[model samples]
Structure formats: C-alpha cells, structure tokens
Target: MIKIHLSRLLGERRLTQADLARKTGIRPSTIGDYYHELAERINLDHLDLICEVLNCTVSDVLEYIPSHKRKK
Candidate 1:
C-alpha cells in the first residue's frame, strides 16, 4: 500500500495541518484528508507544493510497501 507520512513528518517538524495548508496553499480539508490517510487520490500539483513547503522529497512524503498478495 502507498502510505503517506504527512502526520509523522508534521509531528517531527513540530507543524500543524493548518500550518502546512497555509504554507502550501493547499486546502485545509485536503491536507487533513492526507494527514489522516483518508485520501483516495492525490493531486501532483498539491504534492509539489507540499514538498516545496516541507523541504522534502516525494519519497519522504510517501512510501510503498508490498501488500501480502504482492509480496514475493
């Protein structure tokens, strides 16, 4: 599964969802959905903005883990 580490990264950086939204110009609700891992899809533009604001790479924000079915 693709995991989003926004919450963890925010906590580690001592940032709040609102802070991220403001800095990234992304909607607060959108940020909340991502933070909670409730998002069904991600916008690349938003992702870019987030990475820029967080000063992080895409890999730092997302991770891929093979599911049981996909694991060899």
Candidate 2:
C-alpha cells in the first residue's frame, strides 16, 4: 500500500495545513486533500515547492515501505 506520511511530518514541524498552503502558494483544499491522502497524484513542481517550503527533501516527505508479503 502507498501511504502518505504528510500528517506525521506536519505534526513534527508543528505546522498546519493553512501554513503550508500559504507558504507553497497551494490551495488549502489541495493541502487538505494531500494531508488526508485523498490526492491521487502530485506534480513534481508542487512537490518541489512543498519541499522547499518545508525545508525537507523528497525522501523526507515520502518513503516506500515494502508490502508485508514482500518483507524479508
């Protein structure tokens, strides 16, 4: 399963969806969707903006966790 860890990251930074939206020039609704894992896809440009605003790398924002069946 592809999971979004945005909520965790935001919690760690003590930032709200509104804060990120204002910083990234992204809509609050869009940020909310991403926070809730409702976004089907994200643009690379948007990702870059998010990373810059959050002062984090792509890896910090996202991680690939192997499925339980595929885990060693």
Candidate 3:
C-alpha cells in the first residue's frame, strides 16, 4: 500500500487543510481529500507544490510498502 503521511506532517507543522490549500493554491477540497488519505490518485504538479510548501521531500509525505512486506 502507498501510505500518505500528510496528516502526520500537517500535525507536526501545526498546519490545517485550509492553511495548506492557501499556501499551495490547491483547492481546499483536494487538500482535504489528501489530508484524510481519501485520494486515490495525485498529480505530480500538485505534489510538487505541496512539497515546496511543506519544505519536505516526496518521501517525507509518502511511503510505499509492498503487500508481502506488510505485517499481517
């Protein structure tokens, strides 16, 4: 599963979805979807904007764990 750690990063920065949206100029609804890990897909441009705003690398927000590697 590709786990998004956006919620954790936001909490660490004390930033809200609205704050992220405003900073990245991404739609609030889109940010909300990502914030909640409800987004099925993401655009690279949007991801770049988010990383720029958060001052983080892509790996800081996303993690990929193969199914077999996942703990049962």
Q: Model 2 segments beyond 4 Å from truth?
A: 68-72
State in Å the error of residue 57, model 1: 0.4
TM-score order of candidates, best first? 3, 1, 2
List per-prediction Cα lDDT, in the order shown.
0.94, 0.85, 0.93
Which is the winner by lDDT between candidate 1 and candidate 3? 1
Candidate 1 residue 70 C-alpha distance from true site, Å? 8.8
Which numbered prediction scores highest in TM-score against the true structure? 3
Best of the candidates, lDDT = 1
Flag clash pairs in model 1: none
TM-score of each: 0.92, 0.83, 0.94
How many steric clashes between backbone atoms does each model show?
A: 0, 0, 0
Q: List model 3 lDDT by residue over 34-61, tens digit each.
A: 8889999988999999999999999998
User: Which residue runs does candidate 3 get wrong by more than 4 Å?
Assistant: none
Q: How many pairs in model 3 have backbone atoms within 3 A of each other, for residues 3 or more apart or on separate chains, i.e. clashes? A: 0
What TM-score does candidate 2 get on C-alpha atoms?
Answer: 0.83
